[model samples]
Target: MSLESFGEQLRRAREAKQMSLGEVADATRISLKFLQAIEAGKFSILPQAYIRAFIREYARAVDLDPEKTIQQYDMANQEIRATAEEWVSRSRNAALRQTKERTREIASLPVFSQRSVTIFAVLVVAAVAVVYLLNVGSDSSQQDDVSEIAFDKVIRESEAATVRTESGRALPTFEARDDSLRLEITTIDSVWLAITIDNTRRGEYLFAPQRKRTWVGKEQFQISIGNAGAASFKLNGVELGMLGNRGVVARNVLITRSGVQKTQQ
Candidate 1:
């Protein structure tokens, strides 16, 4: 079976169920473009790590046996392999897409807060007072000394007040508990990750080099990583080294408060 034939089979299965690509995409939360790519036998459109997962979801949506479908896909694509450079390129592209999406989301946020405006106003008033004092002291040496002392006092008082305000607004520290789990991911290169927290909340992220993110879960975390060796994990502050070799795909890695449970590659 060729890759194109495999994709055609999947397409036929979907058509047999009378389901549109858009409907499948909505149901599986897979991108429409990815669904289209799958049907078109364009597996290279996605990271290698995600291809199997996406195929499994697509198969399930079309009422096919996900594992069986995945097996067929693997068999069909045995001759086709992605190089390390290709993986790096795909990861970089995914990171760029994620960055653009995040940029759009951040652009919608409020630019300035009331507290920021208040602080700016206070700084402006302080600057004006300092200038007035300096001009008044320009005529005499004694006045200059007095002005310097006043300036220093003003700066100290302003800093003290700012510190007090900041302390009042500061968020409480987080103290990790026995039951909670904290998973921190740090990326050394562009990588794609899918994470499920407590088997409930799921999210997919594309990270650029030198990025760090943390997630908390009560029970466990299930994660899949593309470019596994390019990223490191810390569970409750205990470092778990790279999941696999460079450009390798790691799937269904389980992590709990105790430590990394199992890593599947």
Candidate 2:
């Protein structure tokens, strides 16, 4: 029955639970910034659906009713959007006024003759041909790199062995055949992983059993496994075996031209 803002209500609820923002973040896996935004009524900082999700998580963390909190958040959002629409209408009116003042003579320019249009089209075609030739030359350079390496054979482990971080453990090796390394993975069980191919963060995603994920890397791959025994991996078509046991966590396993190796933590 309280007529307070959604943020105020949530904030009061959180305070009643006697918890800090960081504690809520740790419990819900929601970032502190998002938590702050939620408590500040900065719903515009996040997508509407995500704001609702944050509200639900925050409510759960504070032992508040998620449905009630989400309802309050939705009402508050509708009000905010309504005000935004009013502002947009006023801005549009001002823009129209300004537009009417600018009666520039853009149509005064001479139109292209039929012969001039033909010449312009020809130039555009020539430019496109130049771009195509440049791309083909770059592709040829990459092809030359593959030809330098021998794919007639692949280097692999003598047996399915666990890759280790210790200095004495042998690392697997594969010949670099192109501008990038091709990595193929198949989930053996329900697994979660974080993948970075050539330093690009592909993000953490869940994979069901038998799901295949293929990635390419120009230099190396950085992979973290939530369940090591849940996935089978291949480097350029060479089977590398399962990573580890069930429920095992592998952080930043490195894959490069030299081979697959667990990074030294």
Candidate 3:
């Protein structure tokens, strides 16, 4: 007698064990429809991606060797795989032949002649030269503008370095000394100001009317005021005079232990 197919073997085993499809379905918790399809060998009717799991479940329910049954199923489909391979081989050979014919036809078509190629190369070179000359001219113009801007910046910075005083009355200058310097600023009115001592920020305060702030520094003290006329200064307890013009912002005042000096504009 001929050996049974995978589905026939499953059916025979189930019958020998006297287990109905419904009974196996309930036991395995698989759908009765899918179980029937598995036994019928209509694996496509079930989910082809999970056909192996279905078969395994069915085989186990019937007490058949799941691995052996799967091996037999694979053997049964070997002929189908061979047939598919044969078709794929034929299709690939046909496609390769068509691609070669298309390539040969393209190669046979005329491309640019030597004279056309020479003319095209000359045009490309001319275009590149024109672009280079334009870029060079633009760079030169930019450099000139940059030079003018740099000159203006230098002039502005020189002005900023000088202290602006009323009527050009010569402002005092002090020599750098290592001794301690003390500054006393008494606000005539409320003045917003920032003070720095020895290159470190001391404080920025909005002094109340008539309020006085004093600081002693080892190296130097720098003060900036929002309302110059609102404050008066004393260096080492010697009154220096009016700090600045009313409503005018004084950004720089150089102070040293020797004396108080004016910063350049």
Which structure among the candidates has the greatest TM-score? 1
- lDDT, candidates in the order shown: 0.69, 0.61, 0.61
- The superposed Cα distance between candidate 2 and the true structure at residue 138, in angstroms, equals 45
| Candidate achieving higher TM-score, 1 or 3 | 1
As for candidate 1, its clashing pairs are none
Clash totals in order? 0, 0, 8
lDDT (tens digit, per residue) of candidate 2 on 1-265: 2213778788888889999988986565455666887777765443333456567768888998888877876676556555555655565455444433332222233875676566556655655565566555445433312221221111112112333323535444434556668888888765656666666434345455567867766788887665677798898888887777765555668888777877421
- Model 3 steric clash pairs: 160-265, 161-264, 161-265, 162-264, 162-265, 163-263, 163-264, 163-265
Stronger candidate by lDDT (1 vs 3): 1
Q: Which parts of model 1 are misplaced by more than 4 Å?
A: 1-33, 41-179
Q: Model 2, residue 99: what's the lDDT?
A: 38
Candidate 3 vs. true structure, TM-score: 0.32
Q: Which run of 10 residues does model 2 get worst, by summed lDDT?
A: 150-159
Quote the positional error of residue 32 for candidate 1 in Å: 6.5
Candidate 1 per-residue lDDT, tens place, 1-265, comes to 7778888999999999999988996566565666888988877544455577678778888999988998999877753433333544555556556555654555566885676566556655655565555444333312212233443453344323321111345323335577678899988876667677776666666665677888877889888776789999998889988888766667788888777789876
